[model samples]
Target: MSIKNTIKNWVLCSALLAALPITVTAGNKAEIGVVKDFKVTSQLASRDQAVRMFEGEFFRDPYIYLGPDDYYYLTGTRRHHLSGGSKKDWTSEGVELWRSKDLSSWELLAVPRRLGDLSWVDGLKAHSDEVGKGNARVWAPEIHFINDKWVIVHTTSVRKAMLYVADKAEGPYVETELSTTIDHKHDPSFFHDDDGKVYLTHRVDTVVEMTPDFNELTDNEFKVKPANRKMGHEGLYLTKVNDRYVIFGTAWSTDKIGRGSYNMYYATATDIRGPYSDRRYMGRFLGHGTPFQDREGQWWTTAFQNGKTMDFNTITKAKGLEKKKYTVFKDGIYLVPLELTVKSDGDVFFTPLDSRLVQPGPEEVQKF
Candidate 1:
């Protein structure tokens, strides 16, 4: 897909974000609202079947942020009331949190801060067009331990991205002074540098620095993009890999929303604000998953079921992407091992340890 077409599709996707991503036809072609009829072989389970196996853990744009005290905090866009909620419930309640010493077992924390409890409630209401009509749902909530405090940044379907801070990860959290600056950013996340500068990266390719007190933000002009093109549609995430700064973004394989597989692409640079390198394929169907390391230093990335699929053999035509590496799973969080290596030149080589997740699909638009 050309850059112009990609941008065109993005405009449509941004508006429909509060609705579940779905396709109309099911046959050989799977792009946007179109999917070729495919079969769910005995070895493969449908998306609905996969959701059942999760036992209420189903989430979208899942995040695993390792915090202080040897605990990794888990969070994402969970059902508002924890059951029977729409996947695209923009009116869903506020953030949910879980903590684990080992990723194998998780302990649900009490709701730190409900949507109504947000400190900037009145301001957010004045800003959102959906107020009183049931629309302000939270998505992609990420908590970071910065400056010895737990800071939370989340985006709502109503186009308000706000921040909250608490003394602890599980909090009676309160809104920050910066919360009033709701300028329509989505999938906002934090990157704390080694020297202690906290940067918020969002809006596809923009980054901004936060004041030490967390009360305000610098000019929102810093941008990070693949060497050649803009980063993927959304889910812009940043982390330091060794000495290199690795940034990841999510997109559909065809570079157009609703077509092909959901996937991740990444780039690396020596500087946090940088002339980054060309985009590289991270994994097919791994869009929006968070990358982190285990207690023993083994790396893994979070994966979830965002779409349904049948066996490739059932796919009469997948545009040659059927032959590419792939993995099918349900709508819950799973950690796939990562093979991360840094070269002598300081560029990072990051790929899934599982061979099935190594390449972009044939329908992928951008050539890395």
Candidate 2:
């Protein structure tokens, strides 16, 4: 209220104004721009950059086996750009082995021998003229650990399903001297039942009895296909759930030409060598990949959708299925989580799980 006090207050206010830019003049306003963080331009970009695992290559007919060391081992048909008019040029060399602990990150383990280099090639080629024929590439290799040794049942051509044995998962897998079991089978897969019976599914599912060493196959063989003729099947994989024998395979009718018809389907049966019924559609555009159960009992599949890393739930309803027409896109290998459920009356159904359940890793999110 005093004049001296008012003068002192005015001086203090003037000093404060000189120290700080309380008001910006027109000349300096242009210079007062934002200091943007070039590293993080947007929230979405930042989130994408946080991904750590990268998407892998096209692993067609991917067969992954859980090893004794608690690690997952994967081996598939080696793919190459086969450019030629003749099928002989389509032969691929070695099968690549990949190992991963969490299923999120994978590392290349080794490149095993080609089918042509197998020890029994001399005998097999002598017995069957088709052994060294066109496009006789090793295809759809399915690996399994049986009776203390590793066994790989694979197809050399559309005509031969041969067996290879090894002492280790990551192996120098040697071909057994035995002859081809199913000469006209493609994508041969072995399934060990809870009842301790190991059944191999080649084109038409067959119950095969292996020797104690798992190298030799006995004459114990039975047919499981005529049970369901409607199933124009390919990529057969037999899995036993509870008291049911479930065969998950692919059935695609390319009736609409360009609108490619490749879809994964499944059939169920009470007996292994069954009258397997209830042929149902699983997902469209899924390539010849196998269904596997994780450590936590979660069902998932690693298949290709247009060559990309494509995976979806085995039991979850497939998303974006409303599109009447479907074309197989060359997307890389995709790994998806699936939910498989069975009804009280013994019916089984699968739905592809929510996409939100899987997040892109660093390999997927490119960082500059």
Candidate 3:
């Protein structure tokens, strides 16, 4: 089948599923109006299928930050509850540190810090409102353990991303006083390279060098967008496979809202900021995800299927992208195995596993 046809069929299946009458199982209550689609193929059935880590927790922009002690720390944008607040107000409400030695089980470590607690919250809010992108409220956050300190790089409704630091993973993290900044930044991604250098990818797929101290930016910044792409990049993610660096980011078509589509585009480079190859599309229905490695050194992606707010059929026709099979799953935290293959012609693409598994496991000594 042509790639376009595959994508078309996938979107149609999703629409059919959405049109079905909502059903409730005995004990599992569907949150956010979504029910888990249990009709997957037998080959995809997981051996250990009892994983549901995000149950009852707010879910959006799923991220698993691997800590220094070999534990996985998870967080996401919460549903907004503030009156007259933007969409991400809930994210700023407070952060709950979900810690686990494995992906299956999780426990909350109370490091709750509200957005109002940040000293610059008022100033940032005012600036974001002035810019007219108030909905960007606490959009996406990326946390890293750097230089023996826990650091969070997050963007608010404002035009720039801010840096916060604490002695341990749990905080009262204070904002880092920086001498340099990237204006109008969103979707902060912190990638620490194997050589001990850390790089940041933000709005527009721009990569910049950051000092290990997390105090300032170095004199380097460049957009890694492939010349063939029409839209800019957000939700920047980088991971090294073998000796090559795989860079991926989320992009949306701007023709219309819900009818529009979002997907991940990627390019490869040997160096962090590079002469990257042309862009290629991954699962057409995927958006705003991160590819992480487990303790076993296997590559897995924590990606969510985009919700029904917009459809992708029109976007595919408009964008001239290849027809590809769409895997329509419910929007939630998914743990899918990944296989990276370099095409005979030297093109690199990734194939994700069908089985969705959430492994279980716990909290140790407080790191921060």
Which sections of candidate 2 miss by over 4 Å? 1-58, 80-91, 122-135, 179-182, 225-229, 253-259, 306-329, 354-368
Worst 10 residues of 1 by lDDT: 23-32
**Model 1, 163-187: lDDT tens per residue?**
8888988877877878877456778
lDDT of each: 0.66, 0.52, 0.53
Write candidate 3's Cα lDDT for 177-210 as tens digits. 7612445556777777778887877765677888
Find the 10 residues in a row with the least total lDDT in model 3: 359-368
- Candidate 2 Cα deviation (angstroms), residue 205: 3.8
Error of 2 at 106 (Å): 1.3
Determine the backbone clash count of candidate 3.
Answer: 13
lDDT of 3 at 82: 25
Q: Comparing candidate 2 with candidate 3, which one achieves the higher lDDT?
A: 3
Error of 3 at 94 (Å): 2.9
TM-score of each: 0.80, 0.67, 0.69
Best by TM-score: 1
